[model samples]
Target: MELLELPLDEHLEAVEKAIGEWTEQQKRRCKSAQRTSSVEVAKSEEELRELQKQKLELLEAIKQAEVAREQQKRRIAANENETRDLQAEIMKAEPIITSLKSRENLHQGNLGNLNQESNKSAQAHAQVVDELMKGISLYQKLGLLIDKKRENNLAFIFTQLDPNNPNREFSFSLRIEDNPDVFLVENCVPEVSDVNELLDQLNKTGNISTFVRAMRLRFKNLV
Candidate 1:
């Protein structure tokens, strides 16, 4: 599947600048071509004909640009909605899985320990995993890069942690060619906390000194 993610405002600005320059060049070229084709426009009919053609070309260019802009807005909106929905799904699953874990510890052995709690925890975990995978797949479809630090969030983690450590290695790294927004943990256990929030802050915080100060507060492990 293709990797698709939302472009931040800066990226959209760059796109607008590039498009504006291209459109200006196109307008100039069209006017130049018309100059080369100019004839005796002393006649009102001929002048009107030329004006009509130039106006039509400009109108076409405006329409094309508008269509492209609207499409980008739609794509960005859809991606944001997808993230919110997936986050909500994970939030809903959190309590159920935590409850199952506590229940399992309370009833671990008997002549017939049903293991129902364990099964539910396993199932709840699976549901979270599945939802995350879907989120990742949707990211792949968006076709934008969300990372400035590295590739996806998964790669950012791997680069920080040692792969040889049993507890550090992910089952596999979640990678999408140009996007960093859809990293998901799999098979292997992850450091339990809010990794997504960490990534979001990293992207949002552009300056290094500010980020360090924020990290000290958020992780609480920093000296």
Candidate 2:
């Protein structure tokens, strides 16, 4: 029962058995540490894959935004070009519009002048008619039976007759031509007459009585 009494071989065996147990415990601890290191490596690799995927998505979004920006720029440029062309067309039409307005004003002015000239010609013709009626009244006052027999293009025909005998008659005519200055006498039986000679004498003498005396002498039978 005492230590000294125990055998030496038994003591040696006991020491060897304890050493083997310690070695086995250290091997198990080594295996557990290796498993934990492998799990950590797997987790790190999964995190890296997630980060790479997020970066790729960001790159794709950036590319899409750039393409939209380029499209907007093109649309703006096209609109600007269309506006410029429309302005150019408007500028080209302005002169033609002005020219047409000027022509219309000119035509209106010419029409106004023509209307004034027409009114003046009408007034002059009315004056000539009034003077001719006065001359007819004077002939009637001279005791001559003057009858308006007929009318033609250039003259009015009148027959001067002796009141006692209708057959003893002379034909007198008053004529007007386009020229207002010219005076005419036609069909004088006793002598060919130029009334212009009397008008010239009247202009020189400035005497209405002399002019009347000349007219009476020229138409002595009717006077």
lDDT of 1 at 198: 53
Question: What residue runs in model 1 are displaced by over 4 Å at the alpha carbon?
Answer: 1-39, 42-51, 96-223
lDDT of 1 by residue, 1-223 (tens): 1233345566778999999999999999989877755643345667788999999999999999999999999999999999999999999999999999888777665413546654554565455445544444433332212222332323212212343442342222333222232324332234435545654554464232333233334423311
Question: Which model scores highest in TM-score?
Answer: 2
> How well is each residue in 59-174 modelled by candidate 2, as lDDT tens digits?
98889888988998998898899889888988998898889889989988988997887567556545654554555566554543433333311222223434565445444443
lDDT of each: 0.51, 0.59
Q: TM-score, each model? A: 0.24, 0.33
Residue 186 lDDT (model 1): 30
